[model samples]
Target chain A: MDIVVKKIVREVKRGNQDAFAELVDLYKDKVFHIAYRMLGNAHEAQDVSQEAFLRAYTNIESYDENRKFSTWIFRIATNLSIDRIRRKKPDFHLEDQVSGTDNLDYHSQFAADIDLPEDQVVKLEMQQWIQDEIMALPPKYRSAIILKYLEDLSLKEISEVMNLPVATVKTRIHRGREALRKRLGQA
Target chain B: MACTRDKQQVINQYLDEEMTLLESKQFEEHLHSCPDCEKHVRELKKTTAIIQSASHFEAPKDFTAGVMDRLPKQSKTKRWQQWIRRHPIVLTAAVFFLVFVTSLSAGFGAEEEIVVRGDGHFIINESERTVVIPEGSAIQGDLFIRNGDVEVNGEVAGDITVVNGRHLQASSAQISGDIEEINQTFEWLWFEMKTLWNDAVPFLTPASEEE
Candidate 1:
């Protein structure tokens, strides 16, 4: 996967616009999801995701291909999204506005093979509940937790993306887990 | 082995899979004996699993195309803007240094007063810390004297303006221009604006480029 990404990156560095477009295609959903989850605004998520890809392309020459391209792009996306959120809402507390819907149509296959529609509904609600808890976390801790669990990145990867120490990333994930556990009580 | 430290720490490390083999064994043993700790670990695991299982939304159609369209064209101005964004602190310091140096140059001059002497030209002489237009010679253009006193002793062809000092014009000094001592508040404001504008030109270029 890294080799394929690197090959595309090389093509991009050689001024292949198509290759850059392909790279954006590969990471767009991941970037959008991260931005959407963080900002809770689909429009802002789109803007941030677009801006992230633009920035990545603009700085492609500076990118070190030795590292995971996903890490670098995710770092850009998260930073742009977080910065946008911070700028628009400086006093970002736990917004009670869980405006996202359960659009798991694409991912429903990953859920348990339950025949009951009510079971699926309960699962989606539970997933939404978890998402609200995740969003309630401070952006720093939220990013760490999302990258660690959702994106399935290692502590080292999260640290690299966040430009934080590995220890700090671990601490944030732990604190985020603790916060979620408190909210998700005895479930 | 006995568990002595914070149980929460052990649970967190266990969930993260960071515990050593020995530590894991001890933590599992402690968890079996401690129902509360076990529940805490279970809830944490559930929380993590739910987050991991959260549905991911696909990017909207034409999202990559939008990004491609919005990507900055490979232009010199774009590259320059990128450079400025990357080194903002350095750019700020450079602007500060330039403003400092320019203001210093405008504000601080040599203690020796400037002497301009030419036939049929401005013969403003600042000997003994004064601008004295010596007799018979004419200042051809505008004369601006700052600091010290201005003593006009000869002919002048243009405006003679003195600031922050007394203007002493000899009766025998021929004057074909206005002898104005500009000491108004607005004049000072205008002078300050001119100085700032001159010093700020380089710093304003990037902003214009961005636009």
Candidate 2:
């Protein structure tokens, strides 16, 4: 561990709430991004992120120093998001709600304005298409892809984050990309 | 092997830059001869690029502030106090020192002739009395008393000897020896009293000069 991280761990062990708060500040954005990408909703992402941090704080003692703190936090966020997805009862009408809401209109407008730069517009469209394909994947495969590519984590790191073996992580990432390519009609 | 699914997976790893140099060269050799696998590699690279370039979600503003505000305040003093309290050696030493100080301030009244023997044992030479040990001596043997109170000082190497005594003061004493009492009249009240006293002392004492 870095000296600062060691100090944070010591402080947290000693019940120093400020040190914990600093830790939360340092990793909150990255955690939120991972959760948001996995869950696809700002509110649910925020909830999962908060829950992850809270769980991390409560179980801070169990954190292994040999692993990166970011990996551990992301693991918590990913697990929580996966749990939410699994527990969510299928509701067909929810799709209508998502597309019908003013929030979708606002997001679409935001997406449009974001693509205003002419040279990047095509790239942005392609990214949007790929993101759609990723979202269409099963939650397990989606998580594997996001961690491997979007987060650019190593197979070992992804394994640690997902609580799986390195081989499993590798297989998931490969299979996820294959599935995504097929879904995007590139296969 | 030119376009097997396993070869395609390896090629994907190669395109993702996750393969070793030797593996990359091998994958490229396969890709060179197989146009289908080569196309697959290009598509996978484009897909990786697309996902990598996607905008990362930003957390709401005030996220940190909100979490911190919801979190309980960190009290350095409280933490320090808890740290001190949790250390068994420190806690024991502290309680020992405290009982010593209180015993000294209360004064070993003339009613008890509490004679700690040279062999590191306490000898209460009187009957039907109380003995209080102040915190700085080394006694080596079990206390032996026929009918008197006994108190321990510092570290004793042997068992306590109590005979029809009213009270045994064992605070501030690390007895490596067991305690032996021969009568029901020997009350073990002072240790509890001292513990209660130590716990309550901070509240009652006037505020000393702040550290």
Candidate 3:
């Protein structure tokens, strides 16, 4: 996967749309997932994802191949999501009633369809619960948690993505998890 | 025993898989004996799992095709046009050429005559050649003349040299240098309207015909 991405990146640097298309295909899912998780809306996530890819394509020359392409794309998506959230100035109180329904339904339906072991179901439910908890977090904590877990990025990668220091990323992740645990207990 | 603050650092390194095997084994041993640290690890793991599951999202169908449709088609002609528009030298040269042509055309049709930068020392040798220097004039350099007559009722700071001119005239004209004259007739007329008019349109109306 790394080699393929590197080749596609080279082609993209040369201004080849087909190469860029391959890259887009390669990471579009992950990018959309990150944006959706960060922004909590499908339409906004899609828009943010599209904008991220467009920005990446236009500025492909600026990308450093030595770094992970995934981290770079994730950074773009995450920043765009943050900007969109800031612009919306969404009232947090109403977010639960409005945004939680679709996700809750999706999780419930998936749970019903997937007849897994007891432990797996518990894990899946816990995962869904954590996601909802993350959404309820402040934007800063939410980004920290998403980058640390969903993207499975290192502290260094999270720092690069968030434009923060490694120590800051670690602190955010630590505090974010603590907050999630507290919220989970209340739930 | 209260879990030491160092336990948090240990947990962070453990989560990041940065600890060596011996360190991991030591931490695992510590967790086995400490329920508080064990609970912390479990909570952290659960939180990580939840975030991972919640973040799963799919891209919209035809996302790539949509993006490709919006991108401007790159072609050689388009690139060339954009390059020319952005190149500073090309743009500057184009603007200079336009200004030069416009100024040249405008100068040919101008009516009011004005001595832009020359000195007052001048001569006219042609049959109807007339020169007009306005009043309160100051010439800092020398002026020369050929086969045309001149009328300087203003001032000349340098030498007035004439050669084979018809008429050499100066009215209250100051010449700082020598006034060298060749084959030409000299005249001093006070308020010479014919000479003034003839000088105004020297090429059109010759002085001899006007006189």
Candidate 4:
């Protein structure tokens, strides 16, 4: 898959429009998911995801193939989501989980691997509840927590995406986790 | 036992596995004695687990196509036309200012003439291309200057018109009638619009750049 992606990236660098389209198709879900989790709104997530692809297309010459393409695209999506959230200043309430309903029924392979049906349901509900708590967090803390968990990025990788020091990323994650503990524990 | 703030920070670091071996051992011993810190660590671990289990969202089926459609096309002429269409006010102001400045500069090198009418005592300095109306001099009829400049140092009871010429008014020069330059209606309108635009340019520029 890496080899195929690398080949497509090379073709894209050579100005093949179809290759770039293929690249967008490959990362669109990941980008959209990151944006959705960051923004807590599906429409805004879709907009940010589309914009991230457009930005990647325009700035393709600046992409360094030595690094993973996913990380680069994720970084662009992260920046756009952060900027959008900051600019709009949306009032996030814990009760408003409209975006949470979009994918609650769609479980991952890991969730399916669970032996018991009732346990899977509980796990899914817990996941949904955690997502609501994450949405209620401040943008910076929300970004750090989402990237650390959803993307499963290392602190160093998150630092690069956020353009912050690893120490700062760790601090954000710690604070974000503490906030979630307080909020979710109450519920 | 209750946990100190610094110890609580160490507990968080330990939970994240960021502590060194020695630090971890010390923090473990402290946590063993402090039930509050132990409970906090357990809750943090659960929080981390729940966050990691959060679901991924799927993009709409047409997302890629939509983005491709919105991408900047390679045609320069289309982009230029789009830009011109978007900023109608800016384009109009630019054209008006250009024409205004061009007309003013075109009239610069023309021959000088001064027409002083009845009871209008004036001094003509042909070398300077200037006609000075004296302090006490008051003109009854119209004073028309063509291809020259007028320095109104005294009162004019009648209309003063300058054609392809510049007008300078002093403190004593009060014209009872209208003073007209760039005589056509559209030309006056364009000139006024250009002046208004020039005054407004500084305020308009930063706002446009921000967008």
Scoring each candidate complex against the real one, what DockQ results?
0.39, 0.37, 0.32, 0.36
**Candidate 3 per-residue C-alpha lDDT over B109-187 given as tens digits, one digit per residue, 9 for 90 to 100:** 2232322234543333233555555566766765555444456667776666544443345667766666654542222
For model 3, name the residue pairs that clash: A127-B50, B124-B148, B124-B149, B125-B147, B125-B148, B125-B149, B125-B165, B126-B147, B126-B148, B128-B207
For candidate 1, the per-residue lDDT at A40 reads 69
Q: Where's the lowest-lDDT run of ten residues in candidate 3 chain B? A: B184-193
Candidate 3 Cα outliers beyond 4 Å, as residue runs: A1-7, A92-128, A185-187, B1-4, B20-33, B73-211
lDDT of 4 by residue, B1-211 (tens): 1267887678667877877999888877877888988878777777777777777779999998999898766566655655666679889999999997786655443553454444667888888877788888877666877666788988887777775667899887888777877655466557567657857785766663343
Full-model lDDT for every candidate:
0.76, 0.71, 0.71, 0.79
- Between prediction 1 and prediction 2, the one with superior DockQ is 1
Candidate 2 backbone collisions, by pair: B119-B140, B120-B139, B120-B140
> Which candidate do you rate higher for DockQ, 1 or 3?
1
Q: For model 4, report DockQ.
A: 0.36
Interface RMSD of each: 3.6, 2.4, 3.3, 3.9
Top-DockQ candidate index: 1
Using TM-score as the measure, the top candidate is 2
Model 2 over residues B141-172: C-alpha lDDT tens digits?
55555345666656766666664454445567
Model 4: residues with Cα > 4 Å off, grouped in runs: A1-3, A92-128, B20-26, B74-211
Question: For model 2, what is the C-alpha lDDT against the true structure?
Answer: 0.71
User: Against the hidden reference, what TM-scores do the models get?
Assistant: 0.57, 0.58, 0.53, 0.56
Q: Which structure is stronger by TM-score: 2 or 4?
A: 2
In order of listing, the candidates' clash counts read 3, 3, 10, 0
Per-residue lDDT tens digits for candidate 4, residues A2-89, read 8898898887676555568899989899899999998878899999999999999889889988888888998999999989988995
After TM-score superposition, what is the CA distance of residue A64 in candidate 2 from its true location, in Å?
2.9
Best by lDDT: 4
